[model samples]
Target: MKNELLSLLNKNLLAVEPSLIRKFDDEISKIPGIIKLTLGEPYFNTPDHIKIAGIKAIIDNQTHYAPNRGIVELREAISEYLRRRHYAVSYDPQEQIIVTNGASEAISTAMNSFLGEGDMVLCPSPAFGLYRNLAKINGARYIEIDTEDDKYELTPEKLKTYLDEYHTSVKMLVLNYPNNPTGVSYSENEIKKLAEVLEEYPIVGECQEVCVNG
Candidate 1:
């Protein structure tokens, strides 16, 4: 029976490990009354409006298995939400958007979709631990760029320095705003400058994957 379980698992499973946050959670939860700022676990509950929507979905019998990409209506809502809140452009939810379980799954799925063994992912430090772990689990090398020297942010010059040094070693540059540990946000001008540097390195191609939130 033990051998059967091992046989069923993929070889890559050996390289994967439990989430680092969960490991810390075990130690912190036993502290009886310690205030932990270790992992970026949110203290708030799901807002009432969101909770009620979940309840309504249950009542309306929306419990059936949704499409792999997720329900079209929900995906469309997300598309509009992004356009209204973040980007100026609109996207087709049916074609361009995918609703994942959460940002964690979204990152993992995106990296898995685009990266393979020997590919490199440039993660600006100090990043969400999940990003580093995701690269390892997906068989991609994770390269950390020290952003502390760049005023706790990735500037165009800093980005170019890395690409010039690593050359094609970088397959993707992971960007996060309102960064996890630093809480630093990028200005629109800063984003544009970074984009300008990215445009010069057409070798890296277009990077559309970005994440925000805890």
Candidate 2:
């Protein structure tokens, strides 16, 4: 039965491997007195205030499943946060804002929504490994833009070169700022230049900014 079930699994998913980040974490966690710096696992515990709020909510029986897009109040807070901190752009919580389980879920959702067989996903090299794995799982070709010469930054010139080569086959561009493993980020000027080049293309940009605050 197990063999039959394995054979029935999606071929694309079968080609995908388990997350390297998680595997590294698992290996390191077995060692006693070892400090783990991999996988972005937080070194500290949840703050007392946040923990207390969660406890209070459970005590109040506020444990029902949230709206598909997430709780209305949480979505509203996200909308407000974007408007204030993210270049003053406003998103309608009711229509545009979606509170995901985490950045991983958000990435998976976006890739599944946009990618298909023969489609291409462009990513800067040395990025989060999940980008490549997700693209493979969705049957999309993942191309890495080698940024070694550019100090680990994706410049407009480099991006334009790839866009010209890939043309319409490129479905998505994964831009991970404060990039995983490398810890490199783009400046405001650098981002604007890249945006100018992107404006001419129809490809979706999956901007992963999870480490921006750190």
Candidate 3:
């Protein structure tokens, strides 16, 4: 019998290509004495302190479902950390902040909330691959501004040019620091310059990207 069960699945999912990163890992693992730099994983096991905390939490019966947004204390700690790091931003733990399982899940939650049918996202090319798929998953499209020629950095002039050419159809911008793949980051001045350009798009929100410099 034909697999009629396939028809009940999401049509959009059919178009998603397998993750290139994972495929690259599988092929590279077959090569003898090859160090696979493409796959991102820690070189060390979990720290002893973290392991102790987990054991303590489990013994204390703290392994229950958390609030939908996340635990309030952890959310507050995140908010404080962002502020202390001179991001100059503050979010309320009770509402604005959410603790997700990982960066990918956070991106999904954010995109699902922000993107609607046919909306567009602007991302610099040669970035982390997940951003492109996240936009598509949310029923939106993404415009990858190729940054290969610019030494893997997105400039304010480039952003302005694209925004002008596209005439405001772009719904969001994805900016990353210590960006994946290229491993280049924006200087404080460079970020300020980009912010100046973005001021014109005051209503545009929900810029999605991952930051993991640590």
Query: Worst 10-residue stretch by lDDT in candidate 1?
Result: 205-214
Give the lDDT of residue 6 in candidate 1: 88
lDDT per residue as tens, model 1, 1-214: 9999988876655677787777888888899789888777788998999999999999999999999888998888888887898776687888788887767777777767666777787767886777776677677788888988777898788888888887676667778667877888888898888878877653333223443211
* Residue 129 in candidate 2, Cα distance off native in Å: 0.9
Report how far residue 105 has shifted in candidate 3, in Å.
1.0
Runs of candidate 2 exceeding 4 Å displacement: 209-214
* lDDT by residue (tens digit), candidate 2, 12-66: 9898888888988999899999988887878899999999999999999999998
TM per prediction: 0.83, 0.93, 0.89
Name the top lDDT candidate: 2
Ranking by lDDT: 2, 3, 1
The candidate maximizing TM-score is 2
lDDT, candidate 1, equals 0.75
> Candidate 2 — which pairs collide?
none
Q: How would you encode candidate 3's per-residue C-alpha lDDT over 1-214 as one tens digit per residue?
A: 3468778766665667788999989998999998779867887899999999999999999999999999888989988987788576776778778889887788677667767777888888787787777777677778889998899999999988887876456777777557878888888899779878877763253333332111
**Candidate 3 RMSD to the correct structure:** 3.5
Q: What's the lDDT for residue 29 in model 2?
A: 96
